[model samples]
Target: MLEKVRYEGAYPTREKADEAVRLVLSGLGRQLTGDERVDLAARLPWEAARGLTAQIPDTRQLTGWAFVKDLAARTNASLATTRWDTGSVFAAVAAHAGPDLLTRILHQLPTGYALLFGRAELTQAA
Candidate 1:
């Protein structure tokens, strides 16, 4: 799945793909509550689940922009690249975790995060 996402993202190597997935998961881990994180991890593939469940600092809710900024800082990638990387990684996540879990995740996050997960644009009322 990661390899497929890597190809979709046109990333040059598996290591780069792995790093993107790690960066996204690390940032996501910090945004989710413990239970939400565990739920998400359970829905992911083993390696991806391990990445999500790895020991890390406490989580705090962050807006979508903050999520992207955090990932950029962690990966030392430009914000534009971070956006693309996030989309790629999340596409894989959406495919693996399926719609029900994805919807739950979107509800847990602030509004703008849906776009990163490749969901339809959210209206103000959403």
Candidate 2:
């Protein structure tokens, strides 16, 4: 999964990819409720799941832009890079978790989050 993130994210090295994944997961973990976090963790690879389940700040339901902004702050990366990294990491997540789980995850997040997951942007009605 890290390899896939590295390749898909076009990171120069595994360490960079690892950092991106950690940042994204850690930030995302902070955004998800306990049950949602556990469900997401169950769908990830072991190491990645550990990251997702790690103890951190209390969960807060952030909007999509807030999600990226939080990730950028955690990673000290530009928003554009963070967005790309997010998409890459989430693509790997979606591939591993499959459609049903992915849909459940998406439903938990704000509308625009689907784009980061490599899915079409959710309409306002969604």
Candidate 3:
């Protein structure tokens, strides 16, 4: 998983990739709840799962944009950098999640998460 993140993110070292992974997953652990959270945690490898499950769930859900912004503030990184980091981590996560679980995850999350996971989010016309 770290190898995937390191290569995908083009990070200087495994340590850097590990840091990015932890930060983003910890933020997500705080945000996600219920079945989505538990399911995703079970799907991820142990370390990633721990990073994702360690946080006490946030009672209020944030929009995808708000999630990115909140993560940036928590990490003291610029929004652009934080967004990049989030995508890097989530892209790897999406790969582990597979299509079925990924679809379910996107359904639970607010808009913009699909793109973060490196998937296009298409909506049905009413």
Which candidate comes out best when scored by TM-score?
3
Judging by lDDT, tell me the better candidate of 1 and 2. 2
Error of 2 at 22 (Å): 0.6
- The digit string of per-residue lDDT tens for model 3 on 1-126 reads 889988989999999999999999998898888888898899899999999999998888787788899999987899998888889999899888889988988888888888888888778899
Error of 3 at 41 (Å): 1.3
Between candidates 2 and 3, name the one with more favorable TM-score.
Answer: 3
Question: What clash count goes with each model?
Answer: 0, 0, 0
TM-score of 1: 0.88
* lDDT of candidate model 1 versus the reference: 0.81
**Model 1, residue 63: C-alpha shift (Å):** 1.2
Write one digit per residue (lDDT tens) for candidate 1, span 47-121. Answer: 888877774745467788788988888768899999998899989988877888888788888767889988985
* Candidate 1 to native Cα RMSD, angstroms: 1.9
> Model 3: how large is the Cα RMSD against the reference?
1.2
In order, candidate lDDTs are 0.81, 0.82, 0.89
Residue ranges of candidate 3 with Cα displaced over 4 Å: none
Best by lDDT: 3
TM-score, one value per model: 0.88, 0.88, 0.93
Between which residue pairs do clashes occur in model 1? none
